[model samples]
Target chain A: MSAKGVLVRVSTYAALIVMALATLFPLLWVTSIAFMRAPERFAGTPPLWPDHPTLVNMVNIVHQQRIGYYFLNSLIVAAATTPLSVLVAGLAGYALAQAKFRAHRLVSWIVMFAVLVPNQALVLPLFEMFSAVHLINHYAALILPAAANAVSIVLIQAYARGIPADVLDAARIDGASEWRTFFSVVVPLMAPMLAAVAVLTFVVSWNDFMWPMIAMQKVDMQTLPVALASIDREHYQNIGLMAAGATVAILPMMFVFLASQRYYLRAVSAGSLTD
Target chain B: MARLELQRVSKLLANRQVVLQDIDCTVNDGELISVVGPSGCGKSTLLRCVAGLDKITSGDIRIGGQRVNDLPPQQRNVAMVFQNHALYPHMTVYQNLAFGLRVRRVARAIVDARVRRTAVRLGLEALLGRYPRELSGGQRQRTALGRAMLREPGVFLLDEPLSSLDIPLRAEMRRELSALHTALGTTMVYVTHDQSEALSLGQRVVVLADGQIQQIDTPDGIYKEPSNRFVAGFVGWPPMNFLDGDWLENSGLDAHCIDYGIRPERLLLQPSSSADAFIAGRLERIESFGGEWQVEISRNGSRVIARVAPNPELRRDNELRLWFRREDLYAFDRATGRRLQG
Candidate 1:
């Protein structure tokens, strides 16, 4: 290769590596702090590597701060929400994309309008609705509201559109009922988009704090993020403990994303490039 | 293995646009009928209606003396091979072949045996584990055919199944489709816009135009005795040539009509001096199709094409003499575009 071409290639790779490291630094620092002792975590000139690494901060948060209970609560809420969200969104999205209904346009317009409206703006009304129903301290309050996410529905619709309509028609003629066709053919074809939606729903539900805090007023009913916030308020000076809480809050989402990263990227790119 | 009949079938879109207007035809037991039409002429719509994929706006469809207008596709026992060969991309060839039986709640052993037999029949046994995307176009087409075959339905509806393939593959598939139909002896309704395929593959060709059945007859009958101007013009390849009826009168030929139709191959390049009727025109262009030639000739203001044996003596812009036997000419009433009975 020419010297100039070689220089350009090297510079491009260097820029990409720098950007990747920059994006990862905050998560790495928090994880490192989560493993450091109290003094090392709060030191003015803290080293990148913890001076004396320890799991005491993690253990203290799990035992003293009741993070384990809140972690379980978050897990329950996310587990309940993800599949429900994917199923509801996938069915709605397929209908929006393929079904020959008269009101499809109106329904699509409503979904587009919903997607444009920020979730934060709905928090007040949602909290009031849950409170009125006496579901304020329940997991249903967290699970139901986010079950049919507009963005996930739209993403799934975009992916489902790529599936040829004739394939579904063939299934129908092949002696499969509408529901059978959807489950056997449509759902399997929509697997990538479903995985992508599942990951997004789990992460959003896991990280959600404001609604969870408002809805789950009982101390024992709080999720991980709400519990972490409560710990921060009581132990503002304990940086190591706070980092431990943050690290724990992020672990499940990281693992979920890593496991389905292939499908997630495929779904996202397919959704964005088409429609 | 059943007689399929359509009685006064018509399909109208939601906006009240008529897509299939009062279609009527029948396919006898073990007979293959080709539904041929131009695009938007509702050939595919008719096929879909028969398959129960699209409900007919008004009509009765019967298979083996049983009315099935309201039955769902699955309950109707009709198998459809789509134009795009809609093989499920996520499934292996084996799974795709077995899917219909599996969905019908057939025993697993039977499903496997049927699928394996179909794979062997279609030469897809080696690719049974491969996904649809991993196969070539011909293999995918075979898989689709195999999927439809495994159902062993009473009637098969194929909508332009070979239209997507290249010329050679299409020819090969066309032969395979004909052989399969003969072996199975099932009532098949093949829909295509290509008249050549319709003429070659079907026992009877149903010609449709503008949502109406122009003619439904044996292939030779449709070719030789087109019921209207549309059928004559649409059925033949270099398309039957039409000349103004007045031209025949002006040339002193006895033609009592508004239009006269002549097939390209019927026009003789050189007429004997004693020939009763002949017209002379300037040759405009000559296209060679290996053994045959498409010769374009202009007389007065109109142009006509003649498919003639390639002539070494013919030159462009030269005056060419063409003759047609009186029996070979078709006279049509221009006012209604209907073929005029002698």
Candidate 2:
């Protein structure tokens, strides 16, 4: 290669590496501190690498702190919400993308407006309504409120716009009912978009703190994020224990993102191109 | 198979725009009819209405002598091959072919046998296990055709099925479609925007323009005796030549109309002294299309095209005399654009 080409390539890779390190340094620091022994964690000049490694903090968090219960509660809420939200969004997206209704434009405008509204703004009203129904401390408070995600519906609708309408019409002519067509034909075509939605919704529900804290006031019913915050309030001086708790709360989201990153990237890029 | 009929069918959009206006036609059993029109002329809309995908605002549709205006698409007992060959991308060729039968609750063994037989017929046996994305365009089209053919519906609707294929493949598929129609002996309605396809495929052709039917007749009749100026201009390749009635009257011809039409192939070059020589013009350009030649002539600021056999002696910018027989001419009223009787 020419000297100029080689120089340009080296600089481009150098810039990328610098950006990567800038983004990952905080996470690396947290992980390193989580593994350090208590005496070395808060030394005068903090070490990037631990002098001595230990698993006692994680063990203590799981055994004595009741972290397992909050973990299971988070898992259940996320598991229940993902499929329910995805199904509702998929059906509504298909209707908005393909069906010819008199109020199509009006409905689309409403959905767009809903997407623009902040979820934090709805917490007070939702709390009031759930309290009136006596569901404030129940798991239903977490699952039912997230059933109709406007972002997921709009993402699915954008992805579904690439599918030709004739295919659905052909399915109808082939003796398949509308419900059968959706399940057998449309769902498979939108699998990647659905996967992206599932991952995002799972992460959002798992990492949620404010709403879960407001809804689940009892210590036994609180989710992992809420439980972590409550423990941090009392044990703020225990850096290692707090780091371990943060790592545990973040592990599932990392695994999910890694597992479905391919579909997630594809869905995002396709959505952008169509828009 | 059974005959299909549309009586005074019309469709209006929710915004009160008329999309189809009083469309009337009949398809006999074992007959193939081609609907030809320009874009936005409602040919596809008409097909969708018949397929029960869209509802008509007025009139009735009958299939097998039973009114089916309110019946759902599945109950209409008709199959359609879409223009884009809408095969399920996630399914294999075998699954796509057997989808309709399986949906209808056919026996598993029977479904397998029929799918195998159809795969063989369409030359897709070796590719049965491959998904739609892995197949070529022609294979995808064949899979779509097999999907419809396996149902054995009373009527078939094909909407511009060959529009996506290349020239050579399109001709081959056209012949294959004709042979398939003959073998099945089922009523079919084919929609296309290509004039040549309409002329070559069906026994009868319906020409539409601006959401209205211009003419419905045998292919030969529609070509030779167009009902109006729109069909005359739309159903021909080079289009017919239209001469003003004022010019004809001034040239000492007895023309009692506002417009005169003649097919490009019927305009012949003649000597100036010939008794039948009708008009004189200068040949402005000559384009050779291998076996045939297109000659453009201009006279008194008016232009017309003449299609003739390639002649080595034809020269550009030469004064030419053109003539046509009385029977080859068509006259129309200027204001209404309707055919005037001779």
Candidate 3:
């Protein structure tokens, strides 16, 4: 090959290697900090590798910090939020995409506007509403608000747009009722997009720091990120334990994302590009 | 067997533009009719209206002599094959074909028998276990056809079902579709923008332009006796050429008509003659197309084309006189763009 071609090829590989390192560095550093013996983690110059790796920090986070209960709480909130939001948003998306109503355009614009409004602005009013209902510390406070997500609805709407209009028309002609058409035809067609929305919503609910930090005040009911922050507050110098808790919080999201990476990527791209 | 009719159907878009207006055509019992038109001419909209997918703005659609305008698609007993072959991507070919039947609560035995029969007929027996993505474009189209066929509805609606296939595959599936129509003898309304497919598969062709029916006739009649300039231009490849020349002399030869039309095949390259309408021109280009040569000639600032046998002696800028028999010429109303019938 020509010298120019060889140089281009080498540069491409070098860039990819740089990118790979940039991505892997944080995860590796966090994991290393999580396993380091406290002495090594607190050393003036933190060593890349622990002289002796230990499980003490992990066990301490689980037992002493009550990380198991927080982990369970995060799981419950995320699990509840993901499926409910995906289902509701998926139905709304299908309706907006296929069904004709007088207010269709109006509803779509409204949803778009809602997506632009950050959740931070809604926290005060949402907290006030939950307090009046006496469900401020309950799981409903998180799950209910997360269930009607505008971004997920828009993602599903955009994905469903690519499904040829003929298919939906065919389903209508085939005697499938509206709900049956949704569950049978639209849902099956939407599996890839739904998997993506599920992962995203689950990640959002699991890693929600600000809202859960405010609503889940009680220690027993605190979600993982909130409880992790509390642990960090009390053990400011216990870098090992805090790192272990952060890793525990990050692992499930990693699994969920990696497991459905193809679908997640497709949905993200489709949402941004397609009509 | 069922007959389908559209009665002055019209579609007004959200912008309130009349997309389709006064579309009236009928598919008699067991007959296949193709609606041929240019893109965006609303042929698909008419099909959707008939399939109960779109609502008619001011008219009614009748299937089997019963009004279906107010009915839902499911209640209207129509099955459709989409342009993209809309086979459910997630399902195996067998399940894709079985979907409509299962939705209707068809007995397992009956659905199996019908699907098996359709698979064998479409030569898709081997591919039934595969997903739509695994099948070739032709196979996916057949599977879509099979899905509609299994429903066995009163009328079959196909919206450019073969448009997605490659040219060779489209030709093969066209033959298969015609044969299937013959065997089943179902009322079918096929829509396409391709004139050849419409000409070959449909027993009758409805030529539409700008949502209005230009002519409804057999293939031969439509090609030979197009109702207007739009039909003439829209229905043929290398479309019929038009020249806006006034009639110079009208005499005892009964040649009073003007605005003449002739297909490229109707123009003959002959020795010069003293004929009043004989056009003399300089050959601008010659294209040898295997079976024949398509020659373009310029005359009096107008261009005309003639398909002739490959004449190796013919050179560029060669002078030639092309003439058409008066009987072969079509006269159109200059103002109205409609054919002037003798």
Best by DockQ: 1
Candidate 2 clashing pairs?
none
Segments in model 2 whose C-alpha atoms lie over 4 Å from true places: A1-12, A42-46, A271-275, B245-252, B271-277
Q: Which tens-of-lDDT digit does each residue in B1-342 have in candidate 1?
A: 788999999999889999999988989999999999999899998999998888999989999899999999998878999888998888899988999999999999999989988899999999999998789889999999999989999899999999989999999999999999999999999999999999999999999988999999999999999999999999988899887634465466555546888898888976655444666679999999999999998878788898989889999999887887767788888789999877
What's the TM-score, to 2 decimals, of chain B in model 3? 0.94
Reference contacts preserved by each model: 0.75, 0.75, 0.63
Model 1: CA > 4 A from native:
A1-8, A271-275, B245-250, B254-257, B272-275
Higher DockQ: candidate 1 or 3?
Answer: 1
Q: A202 in model 1: Cα distance from truth in Å?
A: 0.7
On DockQ, who's better, 1 or 2? 1
CAPRI-style quality class for the chain A–B interface of candidate 1: medium
- Per-residue error for B312 in candidate 2, Å, reads 3.1
Q: If ranked by DockQ, best first, what sequence of candidates would result?
A: 1, 2, 3
TM-score of chain A of 1: 0.94
Residue A77 lDDT in candidate 2: 95
Query: Could you tell me the C-alpha RMSD of candidate 2 in Å?
Result: 2.5
What lDDT tens digits, residue by residue, belong to model 3 across residues B1-342? 699988888889878998799988888999999999989999998888888888889877899999988999999989999998777667799998998888889999999999999999889999999998788888888888999988888899999998888899888889989989999999999999999899988899999888889999999999988988778877876778675542223322333444666778877776335333455579999988999999998866788888888878888998976666666677777677888887
Winner on lDDT (1 vs 3):
1
**Lowest summed lDDT window (length 10), candidate 1 chain A:** A266-275
lDDT at position A228, candidate 2: 89
